[model samples]
Target: MQHIVTLLIAIVIFGMIIGIHEFGHFIVAKLHKIQVNQFAIGMGPRILHFQKGETEYSLRLFPIGGFCSMEGEDESSDNPNAFEKKAIWRRMTVVLAGAIMNIILGFLLIAVLLCTSQKVPSTVIAQFAQTTDATTGETITAAESERSGLQVGDKIIAIDGSHIFSTTDLIYKLQTTDAKSFSVTVKRDGEKITIDPVTFHNDNTEGLLDFAVQGKSKNPVTVLSYAAKDTVATAKLIWMSLIELVSGKYSLQDLSGPVGTVSVIEQAASTGENVLERVQSVLNLTIFITVNVGVFNLLPIPGLDGSRFVFLLIEAVRRKPIPKEREAMVHFIGMAALFLLMILVTVQDVSRFFQ
Candidate 1:
């Protein structure tokens, strides 16, 4: 039951994201008075379809993805209203709009998340293990255990004298270091307080104590500042990830398509403690995918939007439009190659998902 609901959520989210993409082209094409044949959701045979005026809108059999089939989109059309018949500038706008929309959507979503306070963990010692008090024969705050000796509202600046970024980073240091006693630096209520490690784990995981970061919301500026920082950080992550992939530091297994994305949704649903956590995880994945979609589409590949811009630039340079047949042939070749590549990549995506 929950699985079905998750699937619906996945569809709605994908539709919103991809629909915005297609709408970019659709609206621009309409403004340019180009003839649009179909604005369909998905590929293959239509499962549900309708036509109003000249355009046929269809929901296709495969619910994986969608497109807007514009007249002369890839070739010159006889109709004066056809895409190829449109001016070079119009074509450029049509080609670039989808990617622009994706980027815009990413920013908007991030902003909304910030406005709603759907943020990373910022509270100190939000969760802790309960332990018994040996001296008083009563269960207290467990001041001597792994979560002990740490008071709330203490600002943490460093772990073992190393500056940390996120809560995850702080935990990583504790889980990675083997130091028994180290100086912890913090500012509690506007005073710098350095405390030696006192809490110790039973299993000696990293041979460390569990002193948490003390977070305070004394000022509203902190929230805005954190939100702005993370939004930019999220955007930068996308840029860096792509560079990493091209540099061969990232592997193909790291790539995910619809299959892999769905698997991730299911995994997060089970693994996350709350709906917000699951949503954040899914949105994080979506942001990466969205940025990749924008980035990949902007690449100068034959079938990509970037490649269309390239062809247009070439025509502009020569001061005459490229031959219709020549351009058509190139698009034909490009699309065929792209389709084959999609099949290959889809197979790889599914194989890795199962594995």
Candidate 2:
């Protein structure tokens, strides 16, 4: 019964995410007077559909993907309201709108998490830990950060030149980097100071995070500020992960498709002991997934909005559009390649379930 409930929740969440993304393109195209042929909530064979005005709205069989199909989107058309007839800037706007909406939704979800939280997490060091010495049985400093010139009240601003917006950035930097020591920048006494070789090593653990961060009381200003910062941080994290993947730091097995994502959502939904805790866990994961979707879609990969925008950019510079057939063929090949990759990833995900 719980598994069924979790599956239903995952479907609804995915529907909302994909629907909002397609709606962004649909609404923007309509506003620019582009003729939309169909606004779809999913892909594959249509399970339910209805014509509304000039557009055919659809709910397809597969919930893996969705689309907002504008006239002349992949081919040339004589209609004045066709997508290809639009000015380059206008077309670029339509192509990028879907990503923008996903990001906006991520931000809104982050705000929801912040509003429900008891305190907002900050980057300032709140306290250090003390551990008993094994030899003397006397209390000794355990926080490597304190001995390395970091103060309790100091607000960490950056690590190795990368700006630290919140604890999210701090934690990410510490976990991902291979460095045992780092050049840390902090705001202390209203002045920024750089501390070099701030070593963070403990006797028991390999983790670099040795000190606790202060939590601010929830208020309008703090909530809004933290929400925005966290959103940017989440997007940055996604981009960094992509970079790592391209650099061969991560393998294709690390990738997740719809099935893998559903598995993850189920795990998150079942995490906490209480209902509120479980909801918050799901919300947190949703924020990450939404922001990741927004960032990933913005990459200049063929068959994606970013690729279409790139073509429009080239068109703008050359004062001529690419041949519709050639552009369509490129997208078709890219889409085929993407579908193959998704199938491979889905197989991996299913194998993991049994293991």
| Winning candidate number (TM-score) | 2
Off by over 4 Å in 1: 118-235, 352-355
lDDT, residue 308, model 2: 89
The lDDT of each candidate is: 0.68, 0.90
State, as a TM-score between 0 and 1, how close model 2 is to the true structure. Answer: 0.95
TM-score of each: 0.66, 0.95
Residues 1-355, model 1: lDDT tens digits = 8879778767776776777788888889889998889997766898889998889988876666678888887566689898877789988999999877877676666555555453334524443434566778775443343353455665556656665444534555555455665567766678877778645454323334434433534344655555444444444555556777888877766676676677677776666678786777677666655656776777787767888898899988997878877876877788799777667767987777577
Q: After superposition, which runs of candidate 2 have C-alpha atoms over 4 Å from their true positions? A: 132-140, 202-206
